[model samples]
Structures are given as C-alpha cells and as structure tokens.
Target chain A: MNNYWSAIVNNLDPYVPGEQTKLSNVIKLNTNENPYGPSYKVLDAIKNSCNNQLRLYPDPESISLRDQIASLYNLNIDNIFVGNGSDEVLAQSFLAFFQKEKPIIFPDITYSFYKTYCQLFNIAYKTIPLDEYFNIKISDYLPKIHKNYIGGIIFPNPNAPTGINLELTDVEKIISSNKNIVVVIDEAYVDFGSTSAVSLINKYDNLLIVQTFSKSRSLAGLRIGFAIGNKNLINGLIRVKNSFNSYPVDKLASIGAIAAFQDIDYFNFTCNSIIKLRNNLINDMINLGFEVLPSKANFIFAKHNKYDAKIIYEKLKDNNILVRHFNKDRINQYLRISIGIEEHLSQLIYILNKIVNN
Target chain B: MNNYWSAIVNNLDPYVPGEQTKLSNVIKLNTNENPYGPSYKVLDAIKNSCNNQLRLYPDPESISLRDQIASLYNLNIDNIFVGNGSDEVLAQSFLAFFQKEKPIIFPDITYSFYKTYCQLFNIAYKTIPLDEYFNIKISDYLPKIHKNYIGGIIFPNPNAPTGINLELTDVEKIISSNKNIVVVIDEAYVDFGSTSAVSLINKYDNLLIVQTFSKSRSLAGLRIGFAIGNKNLINGLIRVKNSFNSYPVDKLASIGAIAAFQDIDYFNFTCNSIIKLRNNLINDMINLGFEVLPSKANFIFAKHNKYDAKIIYEKLKDNNILVRHFNKDRINQYLRISIGIEEHLSQLIYILNKIVNN
Candidate 1:
C-alpha cells in the first residue's frame, strides 16, 4: 500500500474471477463460458463494424442495441440499460440502489462479486444463509422474518456453483414482499432452462433483471451485459454509468449482441445442446456414485460419494481437464463443472470414473 | 428522480458528452473524434479475433495487452492499468487516490468530467480559475499560495476545450510541489503536439499519466484506455478494477490495440496529418477574425470577435456542420472545433466566410 491510495483501497478485497487458462488442451470449465461459438451472424456483424466508423465513439445511449433488447423483451427502450458486462452492471446497481442506511441482502453463497461491490461502495450488507439444499429460501427475505431494515436485495437465479434455480413464484414472492426495496434478479444462467424474472418486471416496479451474452449467447470475449427494469431504474443506472463511463458497451460488442439476438435458431440450438450435455453428464456422474444438484444452468454442481472433491479436481487437472472447486465453508466437497461439447464431457466422465473407482 | 435511487444519484450532475449525430451529410466535429480511420493492422487484428474464442472470457488480467503497453512506454508491466476508456481510467483513479478529507483541485475550465467524477464519488473539490488566456496557472496550485488542504491534482495536458499545452517544466513543478497526493496528468490530447508527463513518472511516484487510443490511434469505438504510473498506484487501480469489472477490455479491443502499437509509422502519419490540418484550420479561423487559442491538440478552440458563439454554432449546424459549444461560465463564447479532413475544413471555412461576410 502507498500513501497515494484512498482509504477504500485498503478495505477492498477484490473478486477473483475463475481461472482463464491460455493452454489450449485444458478442458476449461471453471467460468461456465459457453462451449459453442456464437452465431456466424455475430462474427459477420463484428467484422463489418471494424471499419472507419470505429474512429468515432459508440452511441453513449446504446440506442439500437437497447432497442433490439426492448423488442425481444416486449418492453420499451428506456427499460434496457447495457454495460461492458454484467459485473459492471451489478457494480452500478449496488451503487444505484443499495447505498442506504440499512443493509442490503443476498444469498451468502451467491456470486462472490456482490460482497466485493459492497466493500468498494461502502454499502452495508448482510448475507442470508441458503437452505441446507443450497436453495435461496424466499421466506427468509420476507419483512416479517428478516426483521432488520434492508436497502435492497440481489441474488443470482439458478445460483452459481450450485446450479439450483429459484422458482419463479418464490422470486415473485420475494419481490412482492420487498415492495419498498429494489430486488435484483441476476439471470446470468437463466436461459439454460429456468424461467426468467423479466416477465415479472412490468408488474413489479422495483424488479431489475440482469442478463449477459457470455453464457447463453456465447460472447464472453465481447463483454456485453444489460439490465431490463423500470424506466426509472434504468435511468438511475444510466446516471451512474454516465458519471463513470459514458460508453461502457463498445461498438462491435453491441453489434455482435444484436446479431446474437436476431438468430433465435442459433441461440436455441446452443442452449439446448448445453442442456442435453448437462443432463447426460449428470446421469453419468450419478452412475459413478456422485450426487449432482438439480441444475438449470449450463454447468452442474456435484460431489463424488467416495472421492474427495479437491483430489478429483487435481486428478482431472493432471489429465488436462479443469473444473472449479470452491474451497469455502460447507461446500468444500462440491465441484462445479461446466457443460462442454459431447466429446469433452465423455472424456471428463471417463477420467472421473477412473478417479472415483480407484 | 426516483425514490429507489441512492442519495448520491440525486446529487450527481452527469457529464453530457458532445452531440453525436447520425446525419449523413453533417461534417461532425463535436466530440473530438480522430478524423482518420485506425491503422489497417488494427482492423485486421480485430477481424482475426472474431471467431470461436469469443465463447471464452478475455484475459481478466489483460496481461498480453498490458505487456504491449509496458514495452511501448518503457515501463514494467506492473506499472500499466488498462480500462474501458480514459473516462473509466479517470473514474477508477478518483476512487483509488482522490477520496480524502481534503478537496482535490483542478482548473475551473477543464474537461468537465473531472468535476462530474468528484460529484459522483462524493469527493470535495475546488476549481482554480485558469489565467485570462485559459492556460493552467501553476502558481495557484502551489501550497505556498491559494492554500487550502488538497487531496489531489488532475488536469488534461494541453488542457481540454482550450488545447493550451502546459510546459514540461511547469508540469514537473506541480508534481514536485504536490508530492503527497496523487497527481493525475490526463494525456488524452498529448499526442497531437505536446510532450507527455510520462517521462516524469519514475521521478514522482505520485504521478499517474492517463492516455487513450481514441484521439491518436482512432479506435474510440473500441473503448481502450490505460494509465502509466508507479507499481503501487497501478495495484490500487487493479484492486478497484477487480472489484468493479474483471475484464473491461474485450478480447478484440486488446488485440486491436496491440496491433495499433505495432504500426508506429501509421500512428505518426495520422497524428502528423491532424497536426498539419489543425495548423491550417487555426490560420483560416484567425483570417476569418476568430481568436484561436495556441492549440497543441487534435481540436482547436476559438471564438469569432464579431459574432455570438451560440449564433455561429447554430448557423454552422444550419449548414450541416457541427462544432462543440459549451454553455458554461467563462467559456460560453468559444467554439471547440475538432480538426477534420482537408475537404471538411475547407467547407467549414467556406461556410464561416459566408456567415462572417453576411
């Protein structure tokens, strides 16, 4: 630490993203990135955008892209707010809605970035423990039970590392209960199978649904994420964003995401493939004496009955395969595995069988 | 104006960027975008990066891109911090260094975003009035005079909207005088004709130099910007960035920027062409009875002696030509005109001649 650093810097324990390996042969699954490439149309649109127009700044409002997202969601353009990624959107959301006298609430084991954002913004927060089954318990969020005042609430639907999706009714119940505070539903993994909270947006003025192009649309490298919310909420995010970086979403990323949305067939084909692969992988793991969570995401969470999770992770790594093993409380034995293409999953199962049988 | 918005949002006066129009026939000169396209190599690099790897997340650390920048600046890779744009870099800089009990100081008429950032971050600030000629007055910043507690110092080199370069010795004086707080030298317009304070980074550990690809390399649409500073300051920025957004730089932008640095001849060609255009534009404006500032930037700031600035701005717009006019204190009479191609400038001059003669 230097004398030049602000006091906030001393308190910031920054979020560490999952390993991004440069090694080509590794069966990378840590970050839950899509295994399939984005649509050909996305590639074409990005290429076409790489010309003279790049000299100019991208539209600060991201009008066309937001318009496309609005049309897709059957909402107005003002209902959409885009950013460099969902992480940035979440950061802005924390600042826009959660900075109050009372603490915000989220699942303790949800996306780890929430805590980091709280520290960075000096926003007070309290984490509610997930149910023993690793599910977000909606009853815990009710004012009658929670007791203490909350400024806001946010959690990933189909929570990370434990791909269990919170049911739509429960999501609505939490929103309906927290009528005063904003309820942010992080839907990063919602498209795989789970229903979206986006449909509830019109009914709930305080509901904000955050989504990304990274997992389901397969454009993680492009860095595009957006929020669908009430126009006022979108305006609040826009205020924070404009105050920070006017054009967080770059031109090619915006163009590519628009193209990804245009191709429903391609999006469906890829999401379906990951789901099919995830189901087969789950059954194969169950047969090998592993208990996998009921996953609605592109990835699965499982712990082998006989073998230690870290040891299995190491063994997979030794065989040029990689999966995430969070060395945290209560879930240290669980492993998060992203669904790769068919052959990659087959190879993963073959290796896991050897490790578990031994 | 929503109840859900954080209290800071109510206090925030967001920065309004210069108008970006979609009119085909308009000679756009409002936002100071580079008149020329990026190097062919940069475009080629972005196109080559448009394939399957987009399914994966970009390098969260931006190691390769940082390495390229470090080599170019002759600094260690640890000294470099890349962001979405210079605006984002400035925002992170505010959070990393300038949040203090003491109010930061800057020129009253500078890049308006600095004040907007101060407001957004809840940092107190006092603006030192620029000298009568709109040049940054170094004496006012010295602790010996105009003394109040100061947390930091930041202003664009060849200060924005004025395009008046601060002498290297004067910049050194300010850095040396303010040794305790972080001194940010925004070199967004440094490549045009001014000397950068980058040479003084090793001498002054508190100095952080911010630069961007928008003005010089002409890739504003890609949104790449970076800072060069001591390792400790860079680490502080990294901590904040890691907390906010892991991968602000997309894969294609990183690759494209690397290619931008590779083609030095192209970079020099474009900068020199703009400089040459700027000189000619200045001469024409002066010949037309406008008092042009001694510009060392890609844009020129001038005002017609006989006409009102807003009227001239409106007349230019009537002719499908656009230039920036700030409706603020002290600088309301001036027009900040971005230098365009030879033909665009010639048309501008022809239209101005008509307006002045009429």
Candidate 2:
C-alpha cells in the first residue's frame, strides 16, 4: 500500500469483475452476456447517432431514454434515473441511502459488489446467509430477526452466481418489512424470465428497482443502466449522481438504450429464446450428473456429482471454453455457466462430456 | 426536498451544468464545447466498434486507451488513468486524495463544481480570493497563509471563467510548497494554448494532472477524460474506480478516444483554428467596448462596461444566442462566452452589435 493512499482506498477490497478475455473462437459463457448480438435496431440507432451532434454534451437528465423506460413500466418520468451502468447506480445508492447510523443487510451470496460498495462508502453491513439450497429467504430479512438497526437493504432479484430468483411476493415482503429503510432490488438479470419489482415501485415508496441494458438489452459495451423508483428515491439517487458525475450516460448510449426499449418485440423474442436455451442447458447438465439450481436468470449454477468443479472449469478452459467458478465459501464446488446460443451450447456439452470421460 | 433524502443530499447544492437546449437554431455559447465536431476518424472508429462486441462487457481495465494516453505523454502506463469523463476522474480524485485533516484550498471564483464536490464528499475547503484582475496568486498558497492546516490544492489551468493561464513556474511553486499534499491541476482547457503541468509529475509524487477530451477533441458527448500522475496516485484512483464502478468507459468511447489521438494533424488543425478564432473574438469584444480577459482557452470572459451583464445576457438570449453569466461575487458583471466557429461567431457578433447599438 502506498503511504499517500487514503484510508478508504487502503480499506477497499475492490470487486473483481468476470474475466473479459479477448481470445478469439472461445465459447465465452463466463460473463453471463447474451449469446445473441444487439438488435439490428439498436445497432442502427447507435450508428445514426454518431454525428456532429456528439460535439456537445448529452442531456444530463437523459430525458428521452427515461421517457422510454417510464412508458415501458407505465411510470412517470420522475420515477426513472439513468447512469453509466447499474454498477454506478448501485455505487451512488450506497452513498446516498445506505450510509446511516445503522448497518445495512444483504445476502452473503449475492452480487459481490454490494460489499465492495459498503467498503468504499464506509457503510456498515451484515450479510444474512442464503438457504442451503441457495435461495434467498425473505424471513431472514424480517426486522424481528435482529435487534440492531438497519439503514437499507439491497440484492439482485435473480441473484448472481446462484441464478436463483426470489418471487416478487417475497420481494415485497422484504420491502414492506423494512418500513423505515430503502430496499433496492437490483434486477440486472430480471428480463431473462423473473418478474420485475418495477410493478411494485408505485406501492412501496422506499423501493428502488435498478436494471441494466448490459444484460437483457444487450448493450454492455455501450454502458447504460437505470433506476425505477418512487420520486423521492429517484431524487436521492439523482442527487448522488449529479454530485458525482453530471453526464453519466453518453449520446450513443442514450439513443441505443431508447431504441432497445422501443423494439419491445425484439426484446421479448430475445428473452424468450434465452430462457428456452437456459432450460435446455439445465437439462443437459442434469443428465451429465450435475445438480443445477432452479435458475430464473440467463445462467445456471451447478455442481457435478463426481468431478471437482475447479478441475472441470480448468479442463473446459483448456478446450477453449470459459465458465465462471467461484473460489468462495459455501459454493466453491459450483460452476456458473451462461446460456449461449444452441450451437454454442452443443459445443459446450460436446466438450464437457469429453473432459468428464477423460 | 424528500424526507427520505440522506443528510448529504439535503446539504448538497447540486451543480448546474450549462443547458443542452434542444432548440436547433440557437447559437449556443454557454458550455465551453469545441466549435467543430470531433475528427471524422472518431465517427468511423465508433461506428466500427458498434457491432456484436457490445454484447460483452468492456475492459474494466481500459488498457488500450490508457496505453494511448501514456504514449501521448511519453509516460509509463502506470502513470495514467481513464474514466467516463474528467468529472468522474475529479470526483474519484476527491475521494482518493483530497479528504484529510486539513481543508483543501482553491480559487474562490474557480470551477463552481469544486465546492459542490466538497459538500458531496463532506470535505472542508478554503477558497483563496482571486486578485482584482481575476488572477490566482501563487504566493497566496504559501504555508504562511494557512500555517496550521492545508489538505490539497486544485484549480483549472487557464482558470475557468477568467480564461487566464498560470505560468508553469507558478504551478511548480504551489506543488513545491504543499510538499505532502496532492496538487490537482485541472487542465481541461490546456489543449488550447496553456502549458500543462503533466511534465512535472515525475518530480512531484503529490501531483495529479486531470485533462479532458471534451474541449480539444470535441468529445463532450462521448464523455472521455484521463489523469496523469505518479504510480501511487494512479493506484489510489484505480482502487476507488474499481470499487465504485468496474467499467466507466465503454467500447465505442475507448475506440473513439484512441482514434482521436491517432489523428494528431487533424487535432492540431482544429485547435489552431479555434485559437485563431478566440483571438479574433477577443479583438471584436474590445472594439465593441467590452472588457475582455486575455484568454488562453476556447472561450472569453468579457463584460460591456456600459451595460449591465444580466441585461446583455438576457438580450443575447432574446436573440436566440446563449452564453453563461454567473451571478456570483466579483464576476457577476461578466459573460463567459464559448468560442464557436467563424459562422457562429459572425451570428453572435451580429446579434451583440445590434444589442449594443439599441
């Protein structure tokens, strides 16, 4: 550590994102990216926006894009807030609503970035353990479980690594239970099949639903994400945002995200296809002696009955296949694989069989 | 204000950026945007990078873009860091280095965002008043002025609103005086004509130089900016960035920025023409009885001695021309005008001439 480093920096254990290896011809399933390319409409809109208008700044409010999101959710413009990515929205949320006199609560096996954000913002936090089957138990979040105060709550709806989705009813239970604190539902993987918490945003004033174009919208490289919440929660997020970075969303990203929402037909078709592929992949893994979690997102978390998970991950990597293996507690034996197209899945299965047999 | 708002949000006076008015015919001069569009190569690069790769996440490391910047400055890759925009870099810098036991110091009439950042981060600050002619006196930063405490220092080169450049020697003096404190030179407008303190980074571990592609490369809409400094300082910034947002810059932005640097001849031509136009605009303002500052940036700060600044601003707005007029102490009577192209300038002069004659 450098002597000049701040106490915050020194204390931060920065989040390690999924590997973005640039290897060509690799069947990359590690990052949970959509197997398909962005819609033709998204590509066309971004291409059209690459003009001289780029000389000026974008609308800091991202009005048109917010309008598109609002209309999609049947919410008003005041309910939406946009940013560089959902990660940024989460970061700002930690700064805006999570830092208080009390500790916040999140799932121990949820998105790892939540803990990283707590460290960065100096927010005290307690991680409630997920169930043995890797599902988020809403009862664990009830205030009666702990006498200590809670400033806020946040977690991915269809949680990462485990890819297990909490039912919307259960989600509402947590929000209602946390009557005095904000409950952030990170629906980054919601579009895959899980029900959105967005519909409940109007009922729960403290509920904030964070989503991304990175996942279902197929715009990770464009870096756009947004929040849907009541006006006050959105305002708090926006206030932290304005103080951090005025123009978080760029011009091309704005147009591309707006177009992504506009082509509702394309979005639905893509999500349906991914869900179909996920089910097929799960069937194949189960037949191959793996126990896969009941996944509602675009990925599957599984462990083979015989083979070591890390060894299998390495063997697949040697054959030019990439899947994520977490070396963390309670889940080190599990492998999280993203659902690619049919051909990619066939190739993955073909390789996995060879590695297991060998 | 919302009752759910955090204490930080409640205390913050969010920065008001110059408007991105949707009106087409308005000759906008408020925000200091480049008069010309980015080099044609930027468009081609972004368009080419806009395809299927968008499905995957961008490089959180932003390696190639940092490489391009390092090569440009003839520094090692460790000396550089890239972010969404200089604004984000500045925000991270505030978190990384500036919050300390002592209150940081900046010019009273500098970029207004500095104070907003201070409030957002809860960092105490002391603003040294600019002299009668709106120039920062280097000696004012001497330890003798604030004997007991000083955290850090930052100000725009060719200082904002005044468009006055500080000599490199004076910049060195400030860094030298604050031996242990980080000195941030926000050289956002440096590409026009002012000397950048980037070269002095090797000598001072406490120095962090921030630059943006918005002004010179005409990429405000693209939102790309970078910082150069010692490896330790860069490491602190990186730790903060990774904790906050894994990837701030996107694929299109990375390629667009890299291509902008590759076409140096085009960049030089654009900057020279703007500098030439700024000289012409200064001459015109003086002849029209406006007291203009000696500008080293792509903008001028001037006031017509005969007319109230607010009235002139309102009159220009009536003519569908927009310029920034800050209603603050010492500089309320001035209009900070961005230098547009010859055609835009001609339109501006025609309108201003009419306003003055009337």
Report the TM-score of chain B alone for all candidates. 0.99, 0.99
State the lDDT of candidate 1 residue by residue for A63-141, as single tens digits: 9999999999899999999999999999999999999999999988888899999999999999999999998877889
lDDT tens digits, residue span B1-358, model 2: 6656667888898888998899999999999999899999999999988898898899999999999999988999999999999999999999898877789999999899999889988888999999988899877888877674888889999899899999999999888888778889999999899999988989999899999989999999999999999999999999999998999999999999999999999899999999999999999888888999999999999999798999999999998899999999899999999999899998889888988877
What TM-score does each prediction get for chain A alone?
A: 0.99, 0.98
- Identify the candidate with maximal DockQ: 1
Error of 2 at A213 (Å): 0.3
Give lDDT: candidate 1, residue A135. Answer: 83
Question: Candidate 2, TM-score vs. the true structure?
Answer: 0.99
DockQ values, each candidate = 0.92, 0.83
Error of 1 at A130 (Å): 0.9
TM-scores of the models, in the given order? Answer: 0.99, 0.99
